[model samples]
Target: MADPHERNGENERKPDSTDDANLSARLKSLDARISQASAQRAEAEPRPRSKTDSSAIGQAFRYSAEFVSGVIAGGIVGWLVDRLFGISPWGLIICLILGFCAGMLNLLRASGTIKPARYDDKK
Candidate 1:
């Protein structure tokens, strides 16, 4: 009778030093390939600036500019309406309130607290 541990006149093969060396070499080659590919991809595609890329002072200035522009534009429109309609106080007051609201909205949008509203005209 044949020995139970033997098959085809050879013992069930155990991995030898050569197998370990070959496996280590293959693994090193794979690592080198992965690193090369990663470096190439990084060079080809630069990362975009993240939301926090803006400095605190730059963000503050941007927010203030958005708010102030809305207010100034509203004030100008209101002044024009008041001048044309002869409704002095009422026109100025109503427009000032609207301007303040617009400025606040602009500020919120600029600060990323709110999404900008978009109007689409479907013809």
Candidate 2:
């Protein structure tokens, strides 16, 4: 039985020294070109802003926190009033309404829709 590679002379072929040198030169050229391209791209691109710059997501989170904190504070105060005055539902309900108003007011002020009370006090 004859081997197929032997019949085709595939196993007898060897890489030449010149072929190795040529391949090495091509690889170096490719690496240099790649590095040059990367440098140019870095120079062309704009630098990112610093962390102190507030993004849209940060502003949204701040606004939501302001509104939520107001609501939560109102709920706590209402609960306390109910507990202290021995009123079962009225105190809680009234306080909850007030809390919702406070939350809305806070949101308005934060959004610049309504001015701060201090502005009026100055006048």
Candidate 3:
């Protein structure tokens, strides 16, 4: 029968120089890949901006325009309803609610809060 020690000795033996060289090359490649991935992640992440920055002003202007447009449209609809129904202020109240909804919609659109529909050719 073969000696158990001989079998164990092979398992316990250290790898040769070629194995070490292969391991070193692999580790170097992994390190390079990790560094490249880290750089890519850093580039993809959003950087912080100051509150008083020009972009902030532009965003505020966009929101304000949306809100104002909503309010104006709501007021007009309310006036028209009031005139049609012969109601003095009921239409105004309804218009106010609609205006508020429009403003919220506009805000969502401007802020990219709402996702736009995507068309696929397969459909």
Alpha carbon lDDT of residue 81, candidate 2? 91
Q: Model 1, range 1-123, lDDT digits (tens) per residue?
A: 999889889989888999999999999999999999999999999785567646878888888888888888888888999999998888777887888899999898777677668735663
Task: Name the weakest run of 10 consecutive residues (lDDT summed) in model 3.
Answer: 114-123
Considering only N, C-alpha and C atoms within 3 Å, which residue pairs clash in candidate 3? none
Per-candidate TM vs. native? 0.53, 0.52, 0.52
Give the winner by lDDT: 1
| lDDT score of residue 101 within candidate 3 | 91
Clashing pairs in 1: none
Question: Least lDDT summed over 10 consecutive residues: which range in candidate 2?
Answer: 4-13
What TM-score would you give candidate 1 relative to the actual structure? 0.53
Q: Which parts of model 3 are misplaced by more than 4 Å?
A: 1-54, 117-123
* Residue-wise C-alpha lDDT for candidate 3, range 3-113, written one tens digit per residue: 665674565566899999999999999999999999999999999754443586787887899899999999999999999899989999989898989898878876667
Better of 1 and 3 by lDDT: 1
lDDT of 2 by residue, 7-94 (tens): 4656755689998999999999999999999999999999965555268798688789888888888888888998999997888888
